[model samples]
Target: MEITFYQEVDSTNSEAKRLVDGGKAPGFAVVAKRQTAGRGRFDRVWQTPTGNLALTFAIPAPPSRPDLPTLALMTGLALHNVLQPLLGDRAQVKIKWPNDMLVNGHKVSGTLIERVGKVLYIGVGVNLVSRPENVPYETFSLAEVVNITVEELAEAVTAHWSATLAQWLETGFAPLCDDYNAHLYGRGESLRISLDRERAEWAEGTCTGVTPEGHICLADSEGHVTRYNAGDIDIIRTLQSV
Candidate 1:
């Protein structure tokens, strides 16, 4: 697990890709103190304030080509593990389906996974000292609940991710399903999911939980359960819910 530090960068994920293109092997990480042009899923802007975390890990794709969604959930679980202890009884920490970590219903961390050739670039950002403004959803920072340095938090996350990924590779998502669901946000609440990028199609139902393969399961009024591999989920009747 090689780790490289940068004072500032456009994006840690982008730096990881450049390293991969230059013959750097998997199992290395790029971490930047600040990111000038970070991004999340759907190419949405991801703000990385100074003293926050902007890290990316390059991992070789498994022989079976593991599902990306499952991998993302696994990453979220990893982050949750690192943060749960720090907050310890101070506030509730939950994992939003796919790749987000929330504290008391506000987003505190996010993960973004991208496959490049035979490698997977997993990017993670955490609001340590401050949160972003002008975002659609409510956001929080670790500073609100605890005091910790970026380096300390990054080290904790990477260590937890290594253990989680190892277990996932050996047993798949099935064994971790229950644990992940235990910390899942809105596990059995009504949710509105946008079935398309344009939000033209919608599915409103009770959140049944996530499938073993990491797809979110929603049960409609008629009790028919539909598993969605990709979509944006929002809790019904909530403001700024991701």
Candidate 2:
């Protein structure tokens, strides 16, 4: 639980990876007040200037569950639990399967995890005070919708997030899935899913929550069920390009 805060940096994730690769201990968090080159999942550029949370940490990989995707989902569930109390009904925080935090169907935060050897680097970017308006997409900020300070939210998240992760590591993903589904947004809806870079398909389904291994469960149009292994298939945001 060694936390280091920076006024500004290129990316907390990048910096944390450097420390992890350099043989830093597990649970070392590198938090940046502002990230010049913040990144999202799939190398997407995350835009932020200041007054937002850009935090990353290193967790030493375990002998079991070497896959990074599982840990990423676990991290998302941790965030959901940590922030949900502060959010209340107005903030409307819900997790879009995999690891995207959405507020009223708009992306408010994202998580990116990278593994270097036995160390896993988890990056989390949360929109606290100000949200970008450059892209033709909807976004949200916790401070904009509520009367909470970034420092206040950060402290709460750090405390609750750590506890949630510890529980996941101690037990397993099943219990985590139960909590994740409770805050799930899209339960019964039609979705446009990108099968690959070259193909996209429209599927009408009910979100049956996630699998034991952290895959999203989609009960498709044909009464058949499928689980999406994170990073394999892209779940298109029906509203806008995010």
Give lDDT tens digits, candidate 2, residues 171-202: 77777777777776565654444555434543
Which has the greatest lDDT?
Answer: 1
Evaluated at residue 160, the lDDT of candidate 2 is 73
**Candidate 1 local accuracy as lDDT?**
0.89
Q: Write the per-residue lDDT of candidate 1 for residues 1-242, one digit (tens) a residue.
A: 77898889999999999998898889988888799999998898999979999999999988765564688989988898889999999989999888799999999988889987789899999999999999888999999889998788878888889999999988888898898999999889899888898777888889989988999999999999999988888899783456
- Residue 87, candidate 2: Cα error in Å is 2.1
Per TM-score, the best of the predicted structures is 1
Candidate 2 Cα deviation (angstroms), residue 145 = 1.9
Question: Model 2 off-target regions past 4 Å?
Answer: 21-23, 66-68, 197-204, 231-242
Give the alpha-carbon lDDT of every model.
Answer: 0.89, 0.73
